[model samples]
Target: MRAHHRSRLLAATAAVCALSVALAGCSGTTKKDSKDDAKEKAQNAKADPDAPLKKGLKIAFLPKQINNPYFTVVDKAGIKGIKEFGGKGKEVGPSDPKASSQVSYINTLTQQRQNAILLAANDPNAVCGPLKQAMKQDVKVVSFDSDAGKDCRHVFVNQAGSDRLARQMVQDLSRQIDDKGEIAILSATQNATNQNTWIKIMKDELKKPRYKDVKLVKTAYGDDDDQKSFQETQGLLKAYPKLKGIISPTTVGGAAAARYVSGSKYKGKVVLGGLGTPNQMRKFVKDGTVKEFLLWDAQHLGYLAAYAGAALASGQITGKQGETFKAGKLGKYKVGKDGEVVLGPPTVFTKKNIDKYDF
Candidate 1:
């Protein structure tokens, strides 16, 4: 199978900043400050994998965007997995992937008496209050693809380990650019948890001896919109004519960047690659607009999340380190620190292998 993708976290808009400036009472709270204590309390809950999954369990997969092709594949796979365990499941979310857009769904799911809510958090903390409240009502929360804060969910089914993903992206771009040139990032949102985390690791990865000549020029936000990402790609090129490559770590942004570059004069001159689905990226790769990109099996990611949620909802386990549970047909998985359950590494998709997979 070829490379696949994921999206981003939070971003403060100009209007938001303006409002914050007008209201000096705006308090700044980093991710750690608001979540560390609560996370510690939540992690104290123990696991019991020996118990059987409850019958008639209702699992809801709330993706970043229900309409997004990436999330569509994942949530559908999750729905399939839920049915396999004799649980009722459905995919529900907003058209746009944003933190504020998800709260209402969480509340509705909670009211509907869902046994579990699998989320792909747009922001680490934006939906925390609602999620915590859901937990209070005994609704097991499992976040997948992207993550909510540790304190906010029972388990985070990550597409892959952050460091590994970061290293792969940095290396992929570095290779495409021949390791010596100016590069920029076209990311989903300004404060997206997954986007920022991967960017941070990519920045650190750039510091290694092998990538000494690679200079990072900018990191632009696209708000996960296709047109915005196309414009951002244009802007990056115009602003820095010497820029040799662009990395877009979100599916929307990656495909948009490629679309822009494919028609522009920089088509073959500028290297573009990042997280992308084979379906969306196949044309770009075949056209030579993108050489390769990275992503884990999103189908498995969603499927695993359903099983993990069922485990939590059934008293089979809590989000504790070292807890293991069986995901039907996919085998067993162990919980890691911060209640993380990693799927595995991403695959690279070029013209040679892009056709082999179709998610």
Candidate 2:
């Protein structure tokens, strides 16, 4: 609710509106594909408004991986939301962050007859079959953070607009490096949907004339493990000695990169920026190892996902464009094309404002 947060949200909305217009004018197979997608959505839009959940609805959350701090925080917030709505909530997932690791859990939740399954998919396509089966069983599915395929979920709670977040990353890094230097990206898994999308948009942003002197030297995947991420940061420094900045869009990768840079020889020489929580990046910001980083409220992201799942299960709104629902505390949200719901814009964290936020 800060002024910075409001500006980011406005920027994100403007970016999404611009993208919608651009896509509308495209011709050829892209247009045909859009039409086909719309037809499919129309066919799947029917939901029984009379069939609300009975008492004590059971909801299960399956994050990409368990034991990761970021997912832990977000999942706890989801659980809180579910309980607030008088539903039972549970968290389940794999220890490792792999695309196929969540299949068994999805099957189990489906068999258990959960009212809804809130997921953060590791890969876009790997879990679609199991999720589709869950759908067949009348279990509503909503994805958050990282989404599965569109057909596999009822809704996706996007943390921020893809183009806006990507542009913010580039802008922050460029400011730190004086708009001219070699930079590298430390991403999560190679197949992560959100990470790949942001990376692609970042590549596009770098093509602008203002960034002509900026060179993307390399992109390395850390697999979302703290140790692996730390090692990857080390490898990037060694591989690109002239690297002036690093952008890591995963919380685990961002924190790991900050830790590595804060302790290593590149402490004050190389700048680090990306998506990280206030708790994880506070020390680095205070120490001057990381001057700026960005993240939305993960708690609110989870809370919104839970409410979206509840709305889908209760048939309050079908996953159609312009369908609106009220999420507790956050007010109303409208579903856009592809059943995507933007949580809000990201917040820029710095030493001056970092202490005001807890999550």
Candidate 3:
């Protein structure tokens, strides 16, 4: 029965226009319709950077998966930031990170008249229909971590520059394998925007003259599940005994891969690394299963997302390039092209510095 429900859900997500979502069915709301409505709504009131933030604004964060430790730190930090601005916020999400699992929550939040919905979209387009209806009702949409597509959201809070972070991870991994070996990527969900963006950039980067001998053996998805990632790591090594490294950019995937390699016969033979929180990767680093890894502070990422959402809901900004808003303690940040706000550079964690930080 659970499998049947999931199958139907997947079918609906694949054809969101043919089925009803949070605001009902999507019969006439095509991609062109959403874009057209956005253009029609473009005559928005001017943003006021100095406007005082309003009190008691209703905002909620929906991460890809609530069970993931990375998002736990992120969403809790978001709640902390919202309170600082006199707004009320909470974190809510599905235990499973399916593409369509977040749709029901989006509908419920819109019905509750939430002032804003801060989302880490599972799939860029899967959540667009409900998000558009939410916007039509005056609810602001701010995407963080992953995106809800440009037309569907008012702003995207990026942890770091996408291309820069992806390229940096590739370089970080390449050095560990001596820049020439069979390597595979164990990533999050296949449709995840952030993961896809990083994977594409990494693939493009590997084509350069600098990494000609580094053959990418395969790209596998663990769906951000710990056990699945562990198994995927095991499979990669077994399938390619000559594999020298595995790059997992998702926190869960990276940590799971490390755990797998640490206990298996592949320990020192196969290097495991990628975007990992300092605390989670510390043991792996100390045990010599991982040499180094990269990550931005998840707390800072969530904290910034909350302030950005509040700023939009308060009329302080309209997700336009060049507009700036003040994030409490973190200070001012300017929106870049397509409403992208980058947190900052990611830190590379090694055995020497992994113990110095937590979360």
The lDDT of each candidate is 0.87, 0.89, 0.89
Q: List the residue pairs that clash in candidate 3.
A: 20-25
Residue 167 in model 2: shift from native, Å? 1.1
For model 3, the stretches where C-alpha displacement exceeds 4 angstroms are 1-43
User: How many Å off is the CA of 242 in candidate 2?
Assistant: 0.7
TM-score of each: 0.87, 0.87, 0.90
lDDT by residue for model 3 over 1-359, one digit each (tens)? 99999999988776875554455546555344554475246336589998999999999999998899999999999999999888999888899999999999999999999998999999877899988888888888999989888888989999999999999988988888889899999999999999999999999999999899899999999999999999998898889999999999899999999999999898898877779888788899999999999889899999999999889889899888899999999999999998899999998899898888888
With candidate 3 superimposed using the best TM-score fit, by how many Å does residue 133's alpha carbon deviate from the native?
0.8
How well does candidate 2 score on lDDT at residue 301? 90
lDDT of 1 by residue, 202-235 (tens): 9999889998899999999998888999999999
Model 2 Cα shift for residue 331 (angstroms): 0.7
Relative to the true structure, candidate 1 reaches a TM of 0.87
- Model 1: which ten-residue window has the lowest total lDDT? 1-10
